[model samples]
Target chain A: MKLGFLVDLNLCMGCKGCEVACKVENEVPLSSWRLRVKYIDIGTFPDSSRNFTPLRCNHCENAPCERICPVSALHYLENGIVNVDSARCIGCAGCMMACPYGAIYMDPETNTADKCTYCAHRIESGMMPACVVACPVEANIFGDIEDDSSYISRYIMEHQGGVQVRKPEKHTNPKHFYVGGGNQTLNPLAHQRIEGYGLFNNITHLKHVGDPHHGILDRFLAPFAAHKAVDNKSFMDFEQKKADSHDKSHENEGGH
Target chain B: MVEHGINATNAVVTMDAALPGIIWGWMITLNMWAKSIGTGVVLISAFLLYRHKKESMPSIRWIMPLISFVALNVFLLFTLVDLHQPLRMVNIFFHPHWTSAITVGAWMASLFTGLITLLLAIGLLDAYPDCARHNEIAKTVRANSELYEKFYPFVVFLAIPVTLYTAVIMAESSARELWQAPTELMQMLLAAFMAGSAALVMVSDKWSQEVRKDLALVLAMAVFFSFVMYMGEYFFSFKSAEAEVTLEYVHSGGEYNVQFWMAMVLGFIAPFFLAVSTMKSDNKTILRFAAILALIGLYLAKDVWLKIPQMLPLS
Candidate 1:
């Protein structure tokens, strides 16, 4: 059937609804994502623009992960969907090494390699992928690309000259296509990543133990507990004072 | 005045967390290093046996298998432990995917180990005939020298692929620009010879000086070529941007700078000089020292090469 995905960058907003929906639908563990929305700031402060790109597995025709998987845990489904059988996986992380797009992740819970399977279960049940359903702007389009009547095929036909895939030089021949996406947005290497405390950053805090509040008691009793503890009253007062001062300065500038 | 825009790069990833650093760590390094020793001994020992004949080296038959069996076990152990689903490793055998180099390598290694075990048993029986005389099976096997000869060639042939398959796996790894197959294949082969010869020198204290000299020569040649290849990549990796970025970790004052250079100097350069000196002066002490250094250096080199490439972020 040659199932394919298309993400129209033109219509996509940075809302990340699809990302959340996919996580919720798949029950993807904390800090592990089947789909992620990346924000790239382009140009100078005054003339700058931000690009929002939803990145996920491309499900290449010649999949490197499938080829490198020792146990055939990752195999192509009958409908051209690259499916993963986590039960069969030995968790060698070989697929992680072979996926150029960094789509594959070792599930912290299962300790097995997992990736976006184009929502194969949902596809078999005759439903669209969760990401496609959740995309408020209808940016994500999923259908059988081989069928000329399918939406994805028509989309491909419409954007024949403009369609792009990530890392085409790798010769993966990805079934996923992007329309109206710039190089800076599609190409991972085109930008320098900022390292700091942000969403999906600070991975040490994302350790997926069974208990949600497992280490809280231990952390509270640990060495230098008082020193590490936040003084909420003092911090709030300081923040209030800072806000007041900032308002005064802005008012003074306005007066001037 | 343009404050923010001037000289600023067009795109900066303001939000993302895709960096998975150094997934394959020291365990993989140890796996490759030990595997090299395991396969290398078989390869070099076969050559030595062919040159000197089976009758002359009575101790070598048992000793070669013993070394190979132990080293291969270590290799297999580390490989097992490194896997997140080590208990599920039986899947590789039962539900094997032949297209994967890892699958092929695993099967070959298992078969190779099994054959090495058989050889070890035969060698033990042949060496200690008095002890095993009551076991007619041992006597029958020992009597049939041709059986040993048949197994020897298989070990030799299997050793080459068992050592080289890792390179194919490395090459197959997507976006790892530093691990090109042809060069990696050469490096793996050279490493096998270097490690094999060094190991032989360490164990072959009782063997003839001529044999020792030949081992030293092999060690020297292997070191020289391997060093040249390393240097070639070190200097000229800029052809590929990703490789250049990866190599940055091993560049001067980089994270792996000291380790990489130390490996090159200690493992390859030092051994080359010592091996040549041993060849000329027939100095057993120098030969032994060089072999020790070479083995240690090989481990360090493998560690540096394995780790540095992984430092570069794929996404």
Candidate 2:
């Protein structure tokens, strides 16, 4: 059976109950985390919206981290769960570098690569993941996706139109799915400008979008941009109208 | 701003990506530098012997093997000490993975160390062949000098890959965009050769005009390659947003800008000019100054290379 996660962003309250539960269940170190909440602030000022996305290992079918491990420390179990055999790990940190999601962490205490295992031990005894059970608002859902009658499968089918996964361009075929919000929440790099300090006092900021200095070639290309500006406005207006029509069509379908 | 509503002032985007803790720090960098120098010395010494024949440079006949043996051991020692489980290092040999760069690197290092030790033993026996009359092992070692001379070129060939492997391991990491550049391997290889040659020039008491001139040329090539690699990364930007963010973090007046600029000026530009200016000079003091500067600059460059990439969050 292919196990999967269905996270509903609309239901997440940013209370971090899952984060606390995962730490308590797994006995994760004080400095490390198996699951964490990522707060994304979209737009600016009064027009802005905050999306609290719970981030963890997606357990991708085509996992880059598994392939890049120099030793067989990271491997896939039969149930599609990515397991880390800490006993065999040399703490080379290669898996940490290969993971696009940054799920794996080099645990200094254990001197091995550590990450979420989808609470494999609990699942073996026919129990839900600690994070899934502890979520107060029932935002986190996990079940065998292959079974059409399963909660995760039924929920995904019902909300199939709104479901999305992180970094679809990476072609990892992630088992974890998100409903509500869109690329702004799913794509880690979508927010071009952001500032914050993590729990560990690590600061995050945005990079310069373009080259600071314009060269002679830029000046030469400026006149063509003047012609395109007028056309760009009409093109955007047309796109807005098209989006309005699409929304209306979906509304009619829902009424029926 | 609406009262009680979350705004930019109150909002903070906290990232949960794996941050660079205390692992793979200065110790790893120093270990890599030492390994390159160790391998490089053996390769350069082999070239000198091949070119001038064993009898021509009588001083280097003893000096080269001794220095290389010591350096290789130091390299091996540092590598062992850096491991969290030093005893588990043997696991790399027993359960080897061909796809893993570290596994292959361990094998390469072992082979090079064995060859250098054998070569050094042969050198010591040949230097005092009179001792062979009294000792059986000395006789066997003296007899094997010619055999090892033939094997010396093969060891030198292995040295080149060993030097390149150090950089290849880092470049293989797909997530760190700064380390993923093709030029990184080339840059490290050239820097190793330069550091090795410069270090040799510093320690050697006597240097012939032709030997000095040849080293000057090697130094120039190293500087040129450094410039090419730096420019390649600067101009031909990687398409990913993560790559751009990392590039800007390191290059565009971020915290690492000072260190990056220092590395560029001192490591590449200063050494390039110094080596060029002292090319025709017979003054040993002037040459040593240039050599020392090259070593310092190269070390600083390596420091910046290892540290700056981790500053950017991968996720």
Candidate 3:
């Protein structure tokens, strides 16, 4: 009875169909996504390759996120989906720490944590996730893993492809699987890079929109510290000349 | 040094930060409730002692403090509920997940509260010999002195874990660079020791010299442990990028940040020095203030540790 989505990265068109579909289906506010596509650029410009990774909740069988939620706000269904109950979510973010894959997101509008629920609302009515329907490349395949004849099961058995499971040491036992994939490698912070969707963050929260890797101190303090010194070399030079010449002219007039 | 860049990509770009954020937030919310509860627990104990006028308070002594603690635990229960959709928290208990720490904490708080209540009832039974129904139950149990002595020891033991659990919950989260260390466990343990001793001293009339000495020693040990652990964690983090953010986080002196400093000064250092120097003093007010400070510090420490981590990026 375990229901989940199997995203095939090999067939993905690099279009954020699933992201858009999830937003529309869930009425998710701007910049919040149940699932997202990550683009990784590998090698040099002349001989480079771009990798796209589809990220979603694996719905781990041994969900650590489920273990840490103090109120039991999140629970696993008999069908093996690890979904959050918004009614109880106090907006604490414990599940965020427990989730190693980083699959959960907080929706600012409602101030509640969000994730791919596997479209539990629609699935109960026997409908698939909107992303599955909208995937132009047919990259997203959805069905019950328990059903032996299901497409996902067959795909897994034939190719033995599995989802990009990071931090398996954490043991969340995710149900979502990725097939035939190569994308995202390395920690984004390790490289001192931050890229959120444009206009996603309110302008107030985002002022100096740039990269953080210019300096070690800058990378760490970028969020909380003051902006760098403005480029005023020309202004300084003009001020210095005025100070010298104006002072001399004033002195001569006084003497006369 | 602030790069002023707000556009870096997330290592776990797709991770739903809100989910874990909600859960951790739930634990901290409990700490929030604990802060108020802890304050009331100590203050009420002081008031109760004042009212009883240096007499052997058979039933009323433990009853008041335990009541306050139970209320705190109940507030903790509500926090667990708050983690869910604003309305559907009942499902968690109906379909319980036993392996989760929150569930474990819930059960532990419940069991501890229940035990405290039982201890109080037994004490009450021992107090009134004419309350035949209950005295009969307690008489077969042990000496009245023995019966009188039953619960305080367990409170000490239980308080240890209860105090540490909140910190553990915060520290176990790798997400917050602040809570990721073991120092939180140390902080809780020290604060609990200080709180417990202060509580014990408050309730007693003819203080046991032996118990006083033991408490003094425990107080000293706790002070040392608390300082060592707090410093150890800081030393490690002091050089890290996360540490820089943490320093900035502290400097911001957000409500929780202010709380942490107060906890350090009033909770640990003040009482620590007092415990070392004022061990022989008859002035009880100082001890009470120390306890109050320690408890306040502990609560603030918990809040700061929990909230700081939510601000970090996993990558």
List candidate 2 stretches off by more than 4 Å.
A144-163, A168-173, A181-183, A191-256, B1-18, B21-23, B46-51, B128-139, B235-238
Name every residue pair that clashes in candidate 1.
none
Per-prediction DockQ comes to 0.31, 0.13, 0.11
TM-score of candidate 2 on Cα atoms, chains taken together: 0.80
Worst 10 residues of 1 chain A by lDDT: A205-214
Off by over 4 Å in 1: A197-256, B1-7, B53-58, B132-146
TM-score of decoy 3:
0.63
Kindly provide the TM-score obtained by chain B of candidate 1 when compared with the true chain B: 0.94
What does candidate 1's lDDT look like per residue over B8-82, in tens digits? 655777776455667788889999999989999998888887688555565898899999999999999989877
What TM-scores does chain A show, candidate by candidate in order? 0.78, 0.75, 0.71
Instruction: Return the top candidate by DockQ.
Output: 1
Candidate 3, B82-133: lDDT as tens digits? 4323233444466555655555665666666666556555655555556665
Total backbone collisions, model 1: 0
Higher-lDDT candidate of 2 and 3: 2
Best-performing candidate as measured by TM-score: 1
Q: What is the TM-score of each candidate against the true structure?
A: 0.88, 0.80, 0.63
Query: CA shift at A26, candidate 1, in angstroms?
Result: 0.8
> 2 or 3, which is superior by TM-score?
2
Q: What lDDT score is found at residue A52 in candidate 2?
A: 88
